[model samples]
Target: MKICVFGTGAIGSHLAGRLAKGGAELSVIARGSQLAAIREKGITVRAPDGELHCMPRAAADPAELGPQDAVLVTTKQTALPSVAGTIAPLLGPDTSVAFVVNGIPWWYYDSEGGPNQGTRLPQVDPGDAMRKAVGIERTLGGVVWSACTVTEPGVVEVRSPTSRLILGEPDGTVSARAQAIADILKAGGLGAKAVPDIRTELWAKLIGNLSQGPLCVLSRQDMKTTLADPAVREAALRSLNESIAIAAGLGIKLEINAEDRFARSVNTAHKPSILQDLEAGRPMEVAAIFDLPLLLARQAGVETPTLDLCVALARQTAAAAGLYQA
Candidate 1:
């Protein structure tokens, strides 16, 4: 399989390396210092246990890489618009694009039902650049739980104990293409699963993102350090409860209760991607992780006072840093 990882930063570097290890024809779309470093050192992945190195074709522009069978986008949500114009060179008639990032996806409502079906969220998708460039027909649902960071340009470190990727189709069916992608990832020692009902799976992961992303952003600390304070813990639980309510209103099921979810977060010492972005002065994913849910809550007629408070401040933080967009 010819797979190209667009926005090959921390998560992209790790995934691109794994795909190379799995013997796929892997390429990376990168720019700036990271691109130059990869051109010199190839793609390097330093996990907690070991390192994997591969010299995939690296290019600053998508035209150089041409078309591919699959394109995995690992960039943060806020960077999506900035890169959408450059994404087309990696697409073909049968190319599958999987968004393996965090929070609500730009194409979330593509196959969703109910009153909000086919809705366009300005905060997440903004001007609908991604929706226009990568249409829902070739779009696949993807969720990745690999904790990774680019320690430096062209250097990636896997931060978590286990790395996994979950994939599904928009209409809730596990297609042959999805299974093929999963098998490739698993071959690289990354656990990968193709499941039905991707929307529910997305919501399940989102519950955690909505709960901890903002607190970590505001506290300027990782989940463990932030949740250590009793007040922070209460606020975390409140945000989580409100997310549960919003998901329920949207008819998405929750496997575990909110309390257990918050406890699980409290045990994690990792800083969310949003916090990482803020500390690095990168754009924040305020819309996907927080703002869009608030929109959903309002549409559902759900009360989310505490959620509203955090969302407001989070938006301001993104704006103050010049990361939040209209």
Candidate 2:
């Protein structure tokens, strides 16, 4: 299979390296120093399991690489508008566009069968740009669980010992396309699975971000450090419960223990990506990761006092730092 990873940052670089190692014909859309490094030295992934180096085709322009069997969009939500502008060149009639990023996806309501079905989240998509560009039929949802960082340009460091990527179709079908992408990721040594109910997986992954992301951004610390305080940990629990409640209001039941999940991340040194963006002076992902969840909670009539406060403070911090507009 041929794959083009759009936005080869930390996670995307690691994934593209793995796919190349797994024997798929791979290419990447990249820019700036990272693109130059990948063109000169290829992409490198440093993980506990091993290290990998591979030179798939690298280009800043999507048209330089052409269409592929799949296009994995791993760019942050802040970059989605630009992605919408450039991604058209990377699609064929049968290309699968999997958004392997964080927080609630813009395609969340596309396949949901109910009153909320076909709803567009302007916070995430901003005037149906992605919906109009990618369309519903070729779209897929992806949730990934690897803690990764760019050690340098063209280099990705995988901090987690265990990593997994879950993919699913919008309509809850057991899709051959999802399975095929999962197979490539699994072959590259990540635990990959295709699920029928991806919204549940989305809620499950989202709980962790809701629990820690805003807190970390506020504290300017990693998960292990920021979650060290008893008060902080308790607040994290409240945030998780509220988010879980929001998911329940939306009819997605997540069966994870809130406290246990908090406990598990107490020793993780990974800084939330939103915090990374804030510290780097780049645009923070407040809209998708923090704001959208709160919006959905309001829509569901779920009360999230703790989330509301943290997100407000986090948004303020981002604005004061000049990294976030709203």
Candidate 3:
């Protein structure tokens, strides 16, 4: 398979390395110092399974890589506009674009049948740019569970012992393309799969983000460190319960225990990605990760007082940093 990974940051570089190791004809669209490093030394991932190093064609422009069978977009939500602007060159008629991202994706409503079924989230997409650029028919929703960070320009340090990437089509059908991507990733030693319900998977991952992300961002600490305080852990429980209620109201039942999930993270040293963005002074994902859920809660008529408070504070944090507006 000919694959291209756009925005080869921490997660992108790790996936690129895995795809290369899995025997795909891989290329990466990257920029700046990271691009230089990948072009020089390839991508090296220090994972729990083992150390993996694979070199792929690296370029700053999608046009240089040409069309690919699949394109994995792994940048933050804030970069979607620029990605849409440059993504056309790497898309072919049969290309599948998988957004391996966090939070509610821009294409969440494309084939989703419900009360809010064709509704557009301008907060996430902003003028339907991604819908136009990538086309909804070829879009695949994905969620990843990996604590990966770029220790160096081309080297990624994956702190998580287990990493998984889940992909599915918008209409909840099993897609061959998604399965193919999952197979290659699984072959490369990551837990990857294509499921019938990607939304459920998304919300399952989102509950953790809602429970831990804001608190970690505010405390400037890792998950284990921030949740160490009994009071903060209590607040996280409230947040998780509220998020579950919101998901339930949207007709997606997630069977997860809040305390159980929180307990599992008590010793984790991984900092939430939003905290990392805050520390890096890059644009934070306040809209997609924080704001959109609140909006959906209101739409679903779900009362999320705990989520509201935390998301508001987190939004202010981003605003104060000059990384987010509104």
Candidate 4:
């Protein structure tokens, strides 16, 4: 299968290396120094067990790569507007686009069957931009569990021993291509699965994100340092609980306990992506990652006092620094 990884940053580069290891025909859309490094020395994945080096077809322009069997988008949520039109060149008739980033996705409501069934999240996909270009029928849901950092251009360092990925169709149906993509990742020594209920898995992953993302942004520290103080731990727990309540109110059952999830993330020394964006002085994901979830809480009649306060403060801090827009 010809697979393209859009925005080949830390997670994207790691994922691209896995696909390249599986010996699939792969291409990557990267820019600047990262693109130069990939062209010179191939994309590198540094893992706990072993290091992987795979030279993929890299390009700055999506049209240069053309259509693909599948596309995995791993950039920051706010970067979507800049690359909105550029993504079209990667679409084929049956191509699937998998967004492997955090927070409520653009296609979140496509298969949502409840009180808010088929209700679109304008905050995530404002003005129908994503839906117009990449229709909901061709979209896939992705959830990834990996701790990674880009130490340098084209170099991805994996901090953990195990990383997992889950893929599913928007409507929760099993797809042959989803399983095939999962098989490819498994072959490359990653835990990849095709699931029937991607929403549950999304909320499970999101609970961790909800606790760490805003705290890290506020503390200006990685996961370990920010969750160090007993007081901070309590705050993280409160945020997690509120997120879990919101998810349950949306009719998604999160199998894991919110506190357990927060505790599990306490040891990771990696900086949350939101923190990374803040330090990099890039556009931060305020709406999709933080706001839209709270927006859903309001829509679902869920009271999220803790989450509301923290996320608002974090957004204001980012906005004050001009790293995020309202």
lDDT agreement with native, every candidate: 0.85, 0.90, 0.91, 0.87
Cα RMSDs, all models: 1.5, 0.9, 0.8, 1.2
Using lDDT, rank the candidates from best to worst.
Answer: 3, 2, 4, 1
Tens-digit lDDT track of model 1 for 194-309 = 99988788888888888778778888898999999998799889988988889998888878777777777888988888888888888787878887878888888899887788
Better of 1 and 3 by TM-score: 3
Residue-level lDDT of model 3, residues 32-57, one tens digit each, is 99999999999999999999998899
lDDT of 2 by residue, 1-326 (tens): 99999998888998897888778899999999999999999999999899989998999999998889999999998899899988998899899999998888899998799689988888889888988899889999999888889989989999989888899999999799999988988889988999999989988988888868999999999999998998998898899899899999999988888777878889899898889898889898888888888898899999999999999999999999998886
Model 4 residue 176 CA deviation (Å) reads 0.6
Report the lDDT of model 4 for residue 25. Answer: 94
307: Cα error in model 1, Å: 1.7
Model 2 Cα RMSD, 1 decimal: 0.9
Residue 95 displacement (Å), model 4: 1.2
Task: State in Å the error of residue 195, model 1.
Answer: 1.2
Which structure among the candidates has the greatest lDDT? 3
Model 3 whole-model lDDT (C-alpha atoms): 0.91
Q: Which pairs clash inside model 1?
A: none
Instruction: Give the CA lDDT, 0 to 100, for residue 169 in model 3.
Output: 96
The per-residue C-alpha lDDT of model 3 at residue 73 equals: 95
